[model samples]
Target: MDIPQVISKQAAETGEMGQEYLATGKQVSMRRWEQAASEFGETHCREYETVGMLISGILELDLDGQTATLGAGDSWLVPEGAPHRYRIVEAVVAIEATSPPARFNNRDEPTSGEA
Candidate 1:
């Protein structure tokens, strides 16, 4: 995918945390999450796969019935359609790459504040 170089794109506050996203065609996406403490109360099953590297703070993810606590120096992989939930142990920042582009999947359509 010929990903464009993001020069001055702004971040959109979509979730409890803020997010900046760059979609590369309909194949992949690059995303960054801002530092914010939050917990996804309900479980979610994502239809897209994701691989991410934690940048700062801490996060605890509950996948199926297992919980993994990730610190700043950790990398993670989540397969498609996995039931999971996450809580920010502290404010967190992460860089993630997703396949089956989230925008195309219609996962969280742009909200009023979304860019």
Candidate 2:
């Protein structure tokens, strides 16, 4: 039987994109970006789909050539294999979840480009 797990903010594992792995399941993984730097910007494609919510601060996302600004309470999704990039307009606190467990097979890492 699978057991429920508890992870505190202090215990979260730091990963790429200045994110912390909050939890990782068989089919999905969750992460948190706490006060991410404004210089945080990267262009790349991922193998897994990503859905995220802006908990606080501003973010600008460019997905498949469409750009949008996200504020607190705003959420966005990037389909798997789609080209995307993001710029942090302000220090941000956000939460994101990825399907197929992005941490699996190092899918969480960018496929190309630099931050």
Candidate 3:
């Protein structure tokens, strides 16, 4: 049997924030979002690890209080439960790979004053 397949934004799980996995067991998902400078605040994932590559533009990342600016061709590993935040200095396209698959979804729209 063939595994399930989906395009980045066409998938049912995709939205303004991002996309997540529906079926469990080893899975992979990729998405791209264009962000403006200082448009988003910090985010942290407590359930899964993520590995990602910057496809284009520049990103400023704050990993547990340490800061780094990543550009195209750069990649990093984010362990579960680590607090992190990122903003795009220029329009950016990021490709992310998650392990154990991301089973959650952000269904609610962003609240006022929230990122």
> Who wins the TM-score comparison?
2
What TM-score would every model get versus the actual structure? Answer: 0.77, 0.89, 0.69
Candidate 3 C-alpha error for residue 83, in Å: 0.9
**Candidate 3 per-residue C-alpha lDDT over 6-37 given as tens digits, one digit per residue, 9 for 90 to 100:** 44444545555653333344454444555556
- Of candidates 3 and 1, the better by TM-score: 1
Residue pairs whose backbone atoms clash in candidate 2: none
Pairs with steric clashes in candidate 1 = none
lDDT of all predictions: 0.73, 0.85, 0.64
Write one digit per residue (lDDT tens) for candidate 1, span 1-115: 5556553455432533356775445678777786678775467776689888899999988888789999998988888877777788899889888887765556645333233
Q: Quick one: best lDDT, which candidate?
A: 2
- Per residue, candidate 2 scores C-alpha lDDT tens digits across 1-115 of 7687688989988886568988888888999987754653677888899999999999899998899999999999999988888888888899999998887797776577744
The list of candidate 2 runs beyond 4 A from truth reads 35-40
The TM-score of predicted model 3 comes to 0.69
What root-mean-square deviation over C-alphas does model 2 reach? 1.8
